[model samples]
Each structure stands twice: as C-alpha cells, then as structure tokens.
Target: MQKPHSINLSFLAFIGVLYSFQSILGAITFQGMPAVFRQSGIPPIQIGFIYLLMLPWIFKFIWAAPLETWRQKKGRRTNWLFLVVNSVAIVMLLLLTLTTPDVGLYFIFILLAIIAILSATVDTALDGFAIKESNALDKNWVNVMQIGGGYLGSIVGGSLFLLLVGRYNWKFAVYAMVVLLLMMLCYVLFQQQSVKELGQKSAKQSLQKTFASKQVQYGIFIVVIAQLGLRLAQGMTMPFFIDYGITLTQLGVIGSIGGATASLIAVFLTGLWVTKKGPGFVLISLLAVQISMYFAFYYFSEKAELTLLQASFLLLSNSACVAASFVALYNLLMRLTSPEQAGVDFSLLQGVDTAIALIAGVISGALVQYLGYQSYFLLCALASFSALVALPLLNKSSSPLKVVI
Candidate 1:
C-alpha cells in the first residue's frame, strides 16, 4: 500500500461537502423549489417532472464499478473526483443561472438529471476513498465527521435558506449556491489528494470476480434488503406527515431547526456511545429510539399540546439514528470489501441499496395515494424492524479498515 501524504481537518471537511450536497438538494427541493417554482410562474408538478430527470441517482452503481481501476492506473482518485465534483458544481450553477419555466419543463429536468448523474459519480468515488483511507476504529468517526459537515450545510441551506433568503428573494438562493460552489472550489484546489496506486489487478479483472463470486451475490442481497428497510423507515414517515396537512414551511421548520439540531446532537452523542459501548450498540439503540419516536410522533400528530414537542423529538432522534448509522454501515462496507476490488465491491453495495430505495420510492407514492395515512408509516416502521433483526449478522464483522494499496 502506498502511504498517502498526511491529511487534515480541511480535506475531511471537503469530503463532507461532497456527501452533504445531496441532503442540501433534498432540503431545497422539498422547501425551496415549491416557492421558486411559484415565483417563476412554473407549475408545482413541473418541479417534480424536472427532478425526474435526475433519476440516475437510483442506479449510479452501474457506472461506478468501472472506476475501480480507471483512476488507479493514473495513480490517484483525483482524476475521477475532479471530473465528478467540479462538473456537478458547474452544471448546477448553470442550472440555477439558466432555468426558466418557459425553457420547457422537460428540458430543465433533463439537464438536472445530467448534474445528478455527475454528482452520484462523485459520491460513489468518495465512499470508496473514505473506506480506503480510514481504519476499522476510525471508520465511524470518519463517517460522523463527513455527515456532520453535511448536516451542518443542510441546516443552513435547508432550514435557514428558505426562511431568510427565499422569503427575501428567490434569486438569493442562486447566489447562496454560487458562494458555496466557490468555497467548495477553493477547498478542492488546496487539498492534497496524494493517492498512491493500489498495487492490484486492474478494474476489469476485479469486476469479473465480483460477478463470479457467490459470496458477493449474498453480500449484495444483504446490503440491498437492509437498505430498502432503512429507507422505508424514512419514506413512510415523511409522506404521512405531509398527508396530515403539515405545511411545507412547518415541515421545513421542524427539519431545519429541529431536524438539523437533533442531527448535530446525534453526531456527538454517537461519538460518545461508540466510545463507551461500540458503533453497533450505538446504532441499534438509535434505531430503536427513532422507531419509537415515529410512533410517538404519529400519536402526537393528533394532539395539540404535544404535537410540536413530540414531532421535534421524533425528527431529532431520527437524525441521530441516521448519523450514528452512517458510521456503522460505512464501516460494514469497508469490512466486507477486498483490495483487488474496492470500487466494484462498494459500488455493488451502494447500487443494491439505491435500487431498494428506487422501488420504495414508487411504493411510497402509491401507498400514500391508496392506503390510510397511518399505514404508510406503519409499513416504514416494519421495514426498520426487519432490518433491525438482521443487524446481528450484518455487523458480525468487527474488521478494521485499510488502504487498498
């Protein structure tokens, strides 16, 4: 393994932004886009249609696996990361600059999809790099660090952006993103990549092995099923809350102030528990709390007095559970991989997970339309419950992390 030059807080923060940008998009879409669409004289459903263009995120794994050796022969992840992150920022900045309802709704979405494809590529590469860089013990902390930065950005872009910036001027949203892109660009220019080659088979040979191995097939299945379950836990609750007639502003408020705050707290709390007990212990506990909170929020959704407090707590706990889970799950990914095949292995795991989410997205939309409000969340809780049961086997490896080289 080639030794990387010493890395520091700044680079970790940069990596955090790479992942954080996703949630930022989610937050902006749910909260900011509706108003922006309205202001620009665009139909609300048109926003959704435009987003449908970015659907490639659902199966980014297909292209990600080839990168296993694509960057290696060049001696660093920098080659791919450069194309991915910078391209996404540039295209998104262009989207923000050029979009108009008169531009043809489908065209907007198609362009957005292009950006999403590039961003997802960046995300897949970063996950592979993160695993290669950290060891077993530092894995959770590394994840927490990245996600913590991301959630922090989410807080600003999600919660504060709409409340303060969008209200004053929708165009400010574009300005905010531009500044963020500049900041991101500055971070990229200064960061030391210093990735030495992973002296192993080229990406092509590893891709063949990944498909040939029965063990990998089983591994992929486990990863997919668990991801499906976990995502259901989120999807079910959110739509139900929307159905209950919670305004987008209210949802954003809870998510921004309450949700963001809780996620920040959860990151620190996760660090503490992982130190005291273990990442697995911390993760399972957070999940249980989240599930219980979901039920509590359901009940509180009806009560006038407890509604705000209970809902806030539910958001907070869920954020914490997800924060802690980032560490545990990513570490699991690192443990299950091989040096000869890191990109393919991680991409397969992520692809399976995202495929489950894609199916669940369709299921969620249909469930909300056809079923009673409560049933959607009930199904989500059940998904988490199932994944919870499988935790023991999935987390069986306490294996340390390693550099692929």
Candidate 2:
C-alpha cells in the first residue's frame, strides 16, 4: 500500500493565514465601523450602507459554481485561488492609497462594495482549499486549523485590530489588511501544489456532479437543514446582544475573547472525543447547548455584573457549539469529497449555508425592528424548532473510515 500523506506543515500554515484573512476582512470593515465612521455630519444610515455592502458574500456562490467547474492545465483548484488572492492584494493596496473620509456616502459605499466583492471571492477560494486539502486522518485537525484561524482572526482583528483602528487612522487599517492578504498569498505560492492534487473542477459540471452523489446530496440536506434552524435562531438573538443595554465594545469582548477562547479549547478537546464515537451525538449535543444559550440572550441586563456573567455563559455555549458543529461539518465534508471535485463540493456546501443565512439575516433584522428585542428572541426560540426538524434527517450511517479511540 502507498504511504498516507500528512497535510504538509507549510500547507497547513497557509490554511491558517487564509482563514485568518477571511475573519479579519469582513470584521475590520463591519465591527470597527462605528469607531471610524463619523455620524457627525453623515447620517447613521450611511454607515448602515457600509454594512449592506457585505451582501455580495450572500451571493458569492454564484461565482463559486464556476470555480468548481473550471479546470486549469493541472486538475488542482489552486489556480483559481491564486488569482483570487492576487486580486485581493491589488485591491487592498488600491483601497489604502485612496483616501475616502471626505468622499460622499455613495462613493464610500461603492468602494466598500468593491472590497466586499473581492474579499468574498477570496473567501470562496480559501474554503474550497480547506475542503480539498483535508484527508480522513487529518479531517478533524483540518477543522481545528480552520476554526483556530477564525478565532485568531476575530480576536486579532475584532478586538486587537478594532483597538488599533480606534487609536490610528484609516490608512493604518488599510495597511493592516494589505499585510495580512499578502502573507496569505505568499503561503499559497509556497505550497507548490499542482491543480489535480487540489481538485479544481469546472463549475459547469460541479452542481450536476454534486447531485449525482447520493451521499453528497444527503449530507447537504442534513447540513443545510441544521444550518437553517441554527442560523435563523441565532440571527434573531444576536442583533440584540449589543443593542439592548449591552454596549458594543463589551459585547465585542464577550464575542471575541470569551467566544474565541472557549471555541479554541472545545475544538481541540472535541477532536479527541470525535475519535471515540462518530460526530452524530456530538453535533446534536452542541445544537441543544446553543439553543439553551440563545434563551439567555433574552435575560441579559445592562448591569455590568449580570451582563458579564450572562455574556460569559452565552459565549461559552456559543463557542462550544461552534466547535462541535464545525468539527462534524469538516469531518463529513472531508469524508464525502472526491479529490476531483473537492473545491466544488465544499463551495456548494458553503453556498447552501450562505443562502440559509441570508434569508435568516434579512428576516431577523426586519423582525427585530418591527417587533422589538424580546419578541425577536421569541421568534428565535420558535425558529430553533427546526433543530428537531433536522434530527431525523441526520441519522448516522456508519463510515468505514479508520479512526483511533
């Protein structure tokens, strides 16, 4: 038998850099906006437009389908990924040099929209790489790599970067993003992987090919159904976290530090647990935990102590849930993929989930605005009913893949 290959260290490090870039890019513009955007003369609605700029990501899968269908001279997906990364580098550099503070909201929105468009594409390429590079043995570890990078990016960018954005000018923000994007680009170049090894398929064949697989289709159904419920419920509650009594910066700490730290620990620990039993029970357990945490969002008070404690518990549960759910997703995605269509398959999964999130985000926003926070949480509780809806579909079929207890 041929020796099994490990995920090369250089490749994994590259994965970290890319994942970190994804977390930081959206967050730097979104979460740190209030600190930077002056409501003074400009209406808050203008800043709201900046948030809307991220909408392209909701539509990212349209382009993603082509990514899976197109093949380079080599069968590897990296060619597409390389293009996406280089584009991001050039775009970020351009954004830095163009000073926008004095510009009209329309121009600022257009510039921000361009950034979102390119960054979202970069994300699609990176996610495709995450799915393709993982193997049976390294499946759980690969997820940890992805999640760790996410948490690191959130902390480094959301918390640390937000502070920096506060103290420094917008030029520094532009420079920081450019530096991160370049680091990731360098990592990809160094991996030296061929197209076939990275499983670059043309999007034309990918959707058809994905449906052709009974297993992949079933996995998509299960994953999407769960995502629909989890995301919808969480979306309903999350908008209120920083608005009702709780301050944005405090919520940021709870989310960035509390959530990241807990997720980091849970992921590594659950990596060991998933070794014993399959991910079936772990996923279910995590969903329940997240639902419980969602309820806590309703009870949060502005008082520092109660808010801190409630925020802390919610963070712990949310992080743990992320740890468990993503590990299962990573494992299942890795198990089901063929090297030929790995990038396409992963993008499809993300595309499906993003679709769910988009509907949920819009609805949740409208509901909260109309009905208020308490009612929104009530709707969230109701939406979580889909967890039960997904359970029957999630029935475990034994995977013949090898694992250590």
Candidate 1 per-residue lDDT, tens place, 230-265, comes to 565544444344444454456557777777777788
**Which ten contiguous residues of candidate 2 have the minimum total lDDT?**
396-405
Tell me the deviation in Å of residue 49 in model 1.
7.6
Superposed model 1: Cα runs more than 4 Å off: 1-11, 22-55, 76-80, 83-85, 97-105, 135-137, 153-157, 164-166, 193-205, 212-218, 236-250, 275-281, 301-310, 393-405
Candidate RMSDs in Å, in order, are: 5.1, 4.8
Highest-lDDT candidate: 2
Runs with alpha carbons beyond 4 Å of true place in candidate 2: 5-7, 29-72, 75-80, 83-90, 93-105, 166-174, 184-205, 233-239, 245-255, 301-306, 393-405
- Residue 383, model 1, lDDT: 68
Task: Give all TM-scores, in the order shown.
Answer: 0.77, 0.77
Q: In order, what lDDT does every prediction score?
A: 0.57, 0.58
